[model samples]
Target chain A: MTRITSMKPVGERAIRIGFEERISEETNRYIAALCKAIEEQVHPAVTEWVPAYASLTVYYKPETSGFDEMKSFLESCVKDVHDLEGEGGRVIGIPVLYGGEGGPDLSELASHHGMDEEEVIRLHSEGDYLVYMLGFNPGFPYLGGLSDKLHTPRRDNPRQNVPAGSVGIAGEQTGIYPLASPGGWQLIGRTPARLFDPEQPDAFLLRAGDRLRFRPVDEKEYDDLCSRVENGEQIVEVEEGEHAH
Target chain B: MSFTVEKPGLLTTVQDRGRQGYQQFGLSPAGAMDEYALQMANVLVGNERNEAVLEVTMMGPVLKAEKDMVIAFAGGNLQPAIDDEEVATWKSYHVRGGSKISFGRPVNGARLYLSVRGGIEIPEVMGSRSTYLKAGLGGFEGRELRKGDRIEVGEGAGSSEVHAGRRVASEHIPSYEKEITVRAVPGPQEDYFEKEALEQFFSEVFEVSHQSDRMGYRLQGEEPLKHKNGADILSDATAFGSVQVPGDGQPIILMADRQTTGGYTKIATVIGVDLWKVAQLPPGGKIRFKKTDVHEAQRLWQEQEDILVQVASYGRS
Candidate 1:
């Protein structure tokens, strides 16, 4: 995606800057790059900076600085960051136990797509999904790059409560529930990894721009992983790439 | 120092200034509905500004003092009585151990704030004591005060000499009535509506519909002007007092328990200075809107802040 060419006033105190490209894969890359660049430069007066799937919201203290100054400052920083290509994204592998009690809706979901449960699982795990954004709930990743064959509409009526760590698909996107919440996604499997825990220093386990690969595991393995997690074993492997600028 | 809940009233929850800096995470700043009153109550008893206070809605509970404590109460027109005689509110008072404090029906306003010296002691969740009822997180066990709940009251190192008969000026006291006037600023999504709808919004008198709570207040008024793109918009961040008109045309004022984001278009936002007035309005209160610019709104907010600072300083003295 090209650099942000212009910044427009959103309100009395904030401005919205858009890149040349509409929200796309390249736009997501720009979002991550701009967030890191702005954090390194012009840190003060900024109360909060929230980066969404396609946009970044920068909230500043209006009393301290005017809108014009913040706009110019952000514009300069984005121009500089555009010259440097952003760090390559990290890939995370998540193990899941599909079908049976672990995934009650697997049979039903397969039938809805006119395929067997094994083919559904095979298609789902074969492709790598990109983390578009973290939203809806804490640590819940909105994943993109789903295979067209496994694409399915959400349940007509959402379940009152979907257990945490349940992997599901909705329309063109797929995600894992970080916590028990009402959801309309079609569940295909359950993961043993914990996506969110308030007690941990870094409560959120996933972030935007991270890639994920789902590896299938058995019921015995799921039970064993849970036990290991309870015993303070780290189930998910996270790698910090050298390219992060 | 502590207090025991003898009869937990209609709805009682511990609240502070609010949970700020987390709206991006889909969390509302679930603070006291009447923040001005909460602050005044805390300042009256020498507690910090964000100290936890009991936000009692409509009627209040009967609280029995477990120990001798100094306390202050503000907001609403509830008759707080010790045994039989009525006691004045908005001033600090000393209560002996085992004294019983109960409340009568609210004569005016909808919420009352009770703050004790040093503030109520509770575990902070997500850096706040305010209760977000829908999420079932923060505040006393992530729920409202129930019978048999014992709440601890903070005790500062220094104790001051007792004084009596201090009260807020009669003119300054908020008058809760059947109608309230709200100052507002056009929102980012205001242009989505027709020009005539904007005109009707300011000129018309809207009644507070029955479906109202901490989450939102649905209004009964003239239908909102439709847009060319219809009511479908991407879900985005929303704040308190956001006047959002859904497909039905009725405007819903997003409140403390409102979701972090919404897809409906917002017509306007109630100015910060007038939010307290909106909070005090009863379910059936009539409301009229007056449009103002963001500059004027900011100026009014500064004026309110100045007044609050003066009041807080006077209490300290």
Candidate 2:
């Protein structure tokens, strides 16, 4: 019962919606139970929703709601998202460091998959991924499982500077670049964990149904957690969703 | 009271009427690219209609005043002036105190705003004092407005009284055309184009491309669009007048500091009351797209928010 196939109108103050077009986790658990049933009844001219990789968008406020009153307030924030369960997300962790100079394509993507650079950093620091959307910059993310024997494609000559937290991968996806622009993925590692920080009070260190893992670390614990995340220290930990109240 | 710079033009910064709900963490709601000329230049300088202003861009800054203040300028018409006289945008003045105020060529639009009377004292970050200059974050220091900077102000209607000129109603100003059309609302994809490339994207025209900025605007038509089996998608969200279309089919648009998710194939959007004619177009101008649907684009976006509440009741009397 997590259907949503169409909803359209991404303007005159946003809509999108769509689901069931691909990228599993059962369509990101019905886009995280319709973003937790529209963040539990939000909709006073909505104003923010986003999710992605199977769609959600939302955003409202056309002088306080229009478009059939926000399409029946998002069709009454949909209800049977497979009997909505959600209380899961909040893993976090992060660390990294992988190869030299921010993983210069980690020994050529571990010899293009013959596996070596420490078995491509133990299959990209093994599992627990799933981010499915943040964006092409500012806090980046768009991650999805990967590990199809460490798939790798996007680099037909790309990087014109890839720095800011690196990580990469491309084809069967895997991300992390949160802002040093110009990319084409495949890098392999580098993550001091600031992941977008407009002087943080939670300025994004990952969010679209967050849950990430990764660990590794070694350039002296990535230069001591990059000087304690450049001294506004939050040094990556997260965990918290105990029934995410 | 303040203002100093001395010609830092071709891209001044600080904006407002943006930073809304954090674009779901990928943060790119970087404010005012002409939000009805930033609420009519912050209600003709009586400030606080989302205050902060100064946009400029396409050569304009020259500042000076540093104390007497109380200005206003509004969008698209970089020909403002003072030390040499000629000043006329949506009006509201009162300068003095070693004045100067300047600006000059490009008499049309490509952003202008300005406003003043006690506002740009900069601080708000996530709650926005606008300016996301590709993530340096908030205004005045999140970058731009350089060469001897200075600025400051925000105290309370620029130390009480004296800014009385008001103008606005030239039929509430909004004509900066070099051939514009805008309207858009087409789709969350428009079935990924190619119905004659979505009828040549509403009968072609395009243009505007000096590699544009404030996050987008790279159009340039000589007929490219085609898609239907390529132009990739999966990446989503992207709004401020989206349009996208990549895979070299050329379309871009997405402004007001873009990037809140995207992977191409947008096909249409521009319709927050015609996004100030695509934020006052201008590189090579031209543009086109007409379409209109989200129930008449939210009733012309709530009739352009009741024409900004009748332009704030004509700046109060």
Candidate 3:
């Protein structure tokens, strides 16, 4: 059983439940399982659940529920839940065109580690990552499991506008800019796959507990994929079942 | 049937209670900053309390009624005038088709709620009509009101007659004060602060900085709230009234348009019942916080809900 380290009130209307402080696939799986259990439990007061690296925030209607009522419910849930459903989510393949104008920081990043650009691309593409959560921006996944070698500090002065689909790394994590936003991450590549479409009910391309892997593509493949996405095609590869190492 | 935007003011957008159940997807629940006012406006118009209403900010919009309709403008005395004759707030009026509703200098609060007989007929993106500007999601055309834009009215009871005379009782109307006291529940992360910092936070009189927006209110005080150490905390979910203290030691009250999560150490969350007071606070407004009793907060919420339940009766009696 995953121990719920602490359960505290965010306000009168919400409860935040914390797990192990470390970020790992094991803790993430337990959080995902707990989230699933809570959703299935279906308390009418439960309005939303936000699962992050090591915590899950439950937003409830204060008019219908109080912190004590919700806290006990979470406490009982933590005891009853045992299944760790992590590595088995849908694994999405994102195609990236690395090392160019699209990747403004590739050369700098490569030299920071005293490695060549090609090695950086190879290692980044080979990473089998987990989507710990999506929170910074709509559908922007907080991806984990980046090769430690590729770890780079965020830019001192962030770009005013990092175009959408720009894949970047900051410290221990790698993420993609789902929307055109001002970000501090070191940009290394760009993807053409659309991650967010507010018009669609299945708006987010990723969710907590999903597995993700990157594959390198040449300029021509990138162009072809970009056009297909613009034409409203789902171009990224998706596979069901446990992710392959 | 519709309202034409003759002149879009500083910021005007459609909002309901909020976009719920999508925060995990990184979607912020952008809604009316002043929930009490939004509910009051909707109630006065005989619309469901959560129906989409216009949130008019610092400046006010000039709207022309496309048809004879019952409309109510509540909260903030923004100097609203109809057909060049000023109209009192918190009361519904039967506006003629050609009548123009305009506003001049903001005399009181920062935001005003405008509700027509039928709610704004905007498609719900993620089960809400509230505008989340950063994402260009929800509301009219996924943006703020612009000049020459036409807005359609949604379906409702179709009785605009009785509501025309509806008015919120004077007692129920909240005064927009220059200095406001907001009650708060301690926090999800109050332990992250030093004991003196927590005490200092409640004692200080903070002024709302001009940099404040729908996302957050940056409050400046005589002394910064001291932290245990550096102010970085693990990024986590943020509530509407979360008072987050950053490395600068200043507290930023997370507002309606705040991001889903934040990385600063939050010391407290303003109670839901008192959120409207902060919402109405204009830049340069003064604010003080008090640690509230949980039971008292619940009682206050129930009190407000009780008044809301009798909203229609206020119009009759």
Candidate 4:
């Protein structure tokens, strides 16, 4: 289990819990556990908790508690949950349709890396990416562990509007746009899976620290998957893994 | 009871306090630029603080009331008139159906807030009526109010005793001039800049450039202090009133439309109490920095909150 070395208060009702080591699978597990612990320990006071790539920002109502009191309470809670790390997150598999209109800059990204489209897809699909954080858009996953061969820079001039579910690359990062919005990431593919649905109980399909596996799907499969999603089908499935604590 | 915009001015959007809790997902808190004024206007009309209000920029639109309603206006020094009658702002006024509300040339400030007895009835998106124009997420189909657009007003729950006689104190209204003073504290990333840069920031009066907007106000003056550690930091969470200095050496103060996270280094953050005054400043406005200790900043914040609480209590009476 991971141990928290220090916890610093960022604002009147927020604290930055720092770990001894850089963010890893274990650190991520501890973060989730810490969030759960904080939520349980400090009930109504904890208004919001945002998990970042390496840190968790806990926002609370200042009216309920002051900075010093909250910091001390968090310190005590951290000590209690010192060894309370949870099992690793479930690994999710997402099927993506690559190339053509589905991915306008696939060829450019492939050629930029001195690799063909097939090689790019193979390298990208082979890696088990880690969901570092969810940001840039609602339910948009910032996945790490991109293959070196597939690493590419963001477009010089991003499209004014990138459609929802569009998969794109920015430097070593890969993500799916959960909603249609202006983006600058280099588009390489798109997922028929609904990354976010406000109507659902859990709007976000994925959370930070979850393991992801991308499977290449053909154009026909892409259309079929989209239709399935429109019909209220949850395409992505998670498989339970052994506890890694 | 509502109104139709006969001629939309510079920019008009339905805005309330803002969408909170969604910032982690890259959603901006696209609320009223001058939250103080917005809240004041709402209070004058007996509406909740978060009720959707109209954020009119610079010159306001010519609006035709479709139904009889009580409306209140605040923020800046725009001359708002109803049917050629000069009406005092920051107070509730009764408008007959078909009455025309026109905004004359701007006398001072950049933005204005208009609140009705019952707030505008727009579909709440992600728990907010504030318009995020870039993402097209909330308020009037996620866009600015255009000419010929009809806005619906919810029924007022407060008394209809016609409190049109009441008006907000003029002393509370912020004055927008060529130069403005903003109080700020060193940011989390303030160490990134050189000590000399920090001194330069306080010594110089930065002019608000023309390239400023709701997202960020770009300043034109002395180049911001540069960082020797030039590696682009991973995008991290940002907040309203955060003063980020990009590579260009100019400071950009993030506002309502700022992204949840950004890569630029923030040297300082405008204290919450002064943010409303900052919002009222138009482009080309000169700004002088006043560094305050965190304790003083917090004290001022508490004082402002106390004032707001007092004002809010008055609405209940």
Candidate number of the best DockQ: 3
TM-score of 3: 0.96
**Candidate 1 vs 2: which has more TM-score:** 1
Which predicted model would earn the best lDDT?
3
User: Would you list the rank order by DockQ, best first?
Assistant: 3, 4, 2, 1
State the weakest 10-residue window (summed lDDT) of model 3 chain A. Answer: A78-87
Task: Give all candidates' CA lDDT scores.
Answer: 0.75, 0.81, 0.87, 0.77
Backbone clashes per model, in order?
Answer: 0, 2, 0, 1
TM-score of the second chain of model 4 compared to its true counterpart: 0.96
Candidate 4: tens digits of C-alpha lDDT, residues A1-245 = 56665554432334555565354766676777777678677556666666665566666655456556777777776776655434567799999998889789998988988889998888888888888667666677767788776778788897998998888888888888888878888888999988777556666788776799989999888899889998988888787656632
Provide the lDDT at A59 for model 1: 61
Q: Candidate 1 - CAPRI tier?
A: acceptable
Candidate 1, residue B57: Cα displacement in angstroms equals: 1.9
Native A-B contacts reproduced, model 1: 0.09
**Model 1, A160: alpha-carbon shift in Å?**
2.8
In the order shown, the candidates' DockQ scores are 0.29, 0.31, 0.69, 0.36
What would the per-residue lDDT of candidate 2 be over residues B15-114, giving only the tens digit for each residue? 8887887676678888887788888888886665888878887678888886776788888888888887878888878777778988888778778888
- The runs of at least 3 residues in candidate 4 whose Cα sits more than 4 Å from the true structure, single-residue gaps closed, are A1-23, A43-46, A181-184, A199-201, A231-233, A238-245, B157-159
Interface RMSD of each: 3.7, 9.1, 1.3, 3.1
Could you estimate the TM-score for every candidate? 0.87, 0.37, 0.96, 0.91
Better candidate by TM-score, 3 or 4: 3
Q: For model 4, how does the per-residue alpha-carbon lDDT over B1-317 read when each residue is reduced to its tens digit? A: 67898999989999998887766555677898888889888888877877899998888899999887888888876889989888877788888889999898788888889888889998887788999887777888789888899999988623374556567766666666768888877765666787888888777899988888888898987665666565245555566687888887788888888876666777777877788777988888899888875556656767766776777678768
